[model samples]
Target: MSHEYYRRGKNWFTAIGLLFCVMGGIVLIQQLLIWGIDFVEDFLFNAEFTNEKVSVAMLCFGIFMIALGFRKHEEKR
Candidate 1:
């Protein structure tokens, strides 16, 4: 039972975490744009538009994934 195998697996988790974080960040920016546009139209033209709560959820999940990626997985001797 070599520790190297566990270390390799840990690296994979870090990569996946980073990927999730980046994707979530992109989605968050898109949501902000949509919300900003909606707000402007509603203010200037009296139209109703709202930002979806899912964006915030995605952001939170992404941050959580990023934190997980940095966690160390050391095999107990």
Candidate 2:
């Protein structure tokens, strides 16, 4: 029962992470198309957090969550 609950939790994490990744990717792509290469340069170097930066952060966080969800648990000796 506990294992099943853990599995369900992991599933939720993966699902949410996937959603975040998709949304972030879409927004990032849209920004790229609308703003051009200069935007990319700004995203790389600028200190201020912009919408594009938020999208990139979302993308990174989503990937991290996904990885965490899929990580294997070690058996206690």
Candidate 3:
């Protein structure tokens, strides 16, 4: 029973992570095209929450979640 719960949780994590990754990727690409790489540097150095920053955050978080889900799945084996 608990194993089933874990499996579902892992699936959810992976699914949500993928969604975030896609959304972030789309936004990041759009921002990059509009503002170029210089904007990325600005966002990194500046203490502001811009679309690029949010997208990067989302991308990082998504990757972390995906790794967590996969790690859990492997541990179950």
lDDT of 3 by residue, 19-75 (tens): 999999999888778889897779867977777778889999999878876764445
Candidate 2, residue 75: how far the Cα is off, in Å: 8.8
lDDT of 1 at 64: 77
Minimal lDDT window, size 10, model 1: 43-52
Write down the TM-score of every candidate. Answer: 0.47, 0.73, 0.71
Top candidate, metric TM-score: 2
Residue range 27-64, candidate 1, lDDT tens digits: 65765576775653454344333333444455567677
Cα lDDT, model 3, residue 76? 32
- Among these predicted structures, which one has the highest lDDT? 2
The lDDT per prediction is: 0.59, 0.81, 0.80
The global Cα lDDT (0 to 1) of model 3 is 0.80
Which 10-residue span in candidate 2 carries the lowest summed lDDT?
1-10
* Candidate 1 accuracy as TM-score: 0.47
